[model samples]
Target: MIKVFYIEDNNGQYISADGSKRWTRLTGQALYDFLQTERGKKTHFFVDTDDNGVAIGVEIRNTELASNLKGDKNHSDYLKQVRDESGYITVSFDYFETEDGTSTGDEVIPNDEDSIENDVLRQFDLETLRRALDTLTEDEHALICALFLQDKPMTEREYAKSIGVPRTTLEHRKKLVLQKLIKFF
Candidate 1:
């Protein structure tokens, strides 16, 4: 028997943004592990079965599912190899602290007033930002992380060309990402 896993809240209440039920099937366990560990959430996994009560696949709902929906050609073929070599697929989810150590409300403020520029940047909670970011598509997250979360940043044109998109499209995407981040603030 095969099982399908769908992610629900820690309490197992699964609902979409419109207050409707959402469901989908998970193909590969590697894909499942990528989402659970990378996103750091408690997922409610549901096993799927045939009419004969034989396990089949897992049901899932999230941006991760959407991103991998068509299944990349290489990745899909690779998963097939993995499934052939292994007898079973396994996946699990867990929750962990977003930050290391404890944060005290009494951290010292910098005396350099120039260091603080955007008011929105100053007021964001780390956990809230993380949650908001998780709402973004995988591509958007990857682009933003590549640009802002690196020591050396890629030029907009260079990054755009690398992704096979127009420079203007990249700029527009960056703007949208900034707007989403601002909403969290």
Candidate 2:
């Protein structure tokens, strides 16, 4: 079972399942209410404590939000990392096999001739895209990379802050760059 503990004063305390502990009494209701209001594709878990402040039970609700929260949709390693980082109850959903015989999560299939052909086509497309991008000025290219190519792209506000520009100014520049790139395409 994935455990969630409450952190107070740099200490981790187990969540009670019986609602008999202090933190359970004070924070449990508010937490549960928040969970209800925010319920969606992820699993919602409530930790309950017993009289001596030991965690007794963790209540988990099933939701598709689990997939999004975990990023991988079928693995719990990220969930464990989240638990370690946040000190919150970590919950994982049951992975059931689909009747439609789709991938059972993260399994890699060997490439076939069709897959190789697709990869070649994709590479060609990327090459064309690169050629098109070559028409952009250096600043425009940088702007495009900031807006799109980074592994974790920054928000407009973040990009503006990094560049010491106002958000509106950044937005305007972004618009102009996009227009130029579109014309090139």
Candidate 3:
């Protein structure tokens, strides 16, 4: 009753578990905690067991698993000692589950089309932008909108006169609004 779980690497190949001739014995509670902590980090996990339903070793899915496993060699070695003391030669793992599930491997990195579009749009999120505009006092919103719509960029003084706000107040509001909008981008 042993189950093995693993995932293929970016290269479309799974690292062979067979090369590591080590057995780490863990109690059911310990295994559950390990699975919970390692779940999102790796692709999968599995339990190895005997025909009599006796628990054996466990297999982890990715390089993250290996890194976590090797974090403290002394602890792992102790677990191996425990397994040997209990009489299992080496850990068993499921191979079929490790088959590559991704159609596109690391040979090709997908282009960031959305990022390119965002760069072109600059600080634009229709809803958030609109809400940010709405939050502005009417005069401030009108002034900012006018400046944005204009083909040319205007200085704070020019914008202040156009919006009819004092130069200092206009500059302050502009800074605050711009700061809020920056998060959208």
Q: Is candidate 2 or candidate 3 better by TM-score?
A: 2
**Using Cα atoms with residue i matched to residue i, what is each candidate's TM-score against the true structure?**
0.33, 0.39, 0.29
Model 3 misplaced regions, further than 4 Å? 1-124, 180-185
- Let me know the TM-score candidate 3 reaches against the reference structure: 0.29
Model 3 — which ten-residue stretch has the worst lDDT?
A: 3-12
RMSD of each: 23.5, 14.6, 19.5
Question: How are the candidates ranked when ordered by TM-score, highest leading?
Answer: 2, 1, 3
Per-residue lDDT for 125-175 in model 2, tens only? Answer: 888779878988887787789879999888989988988999999999999
- Give candidate 2's error at residue 119 in angstroms: 1.0
Q: Which residue segments of model 1 deviate by more than 4 Å? A: 1-124
lDDT of 1 by residue, 20-102 (tens): 66544344684457456844254423333468875553334464764464356457667868988997553322222226645
lDDT rank, highest first? 1, 2, 3
lDDT (Cα) of model 1: 0.64
For the record, the alpha-carbon RMSD of candidate 2 to the native fold, in angstroms, is 14.6
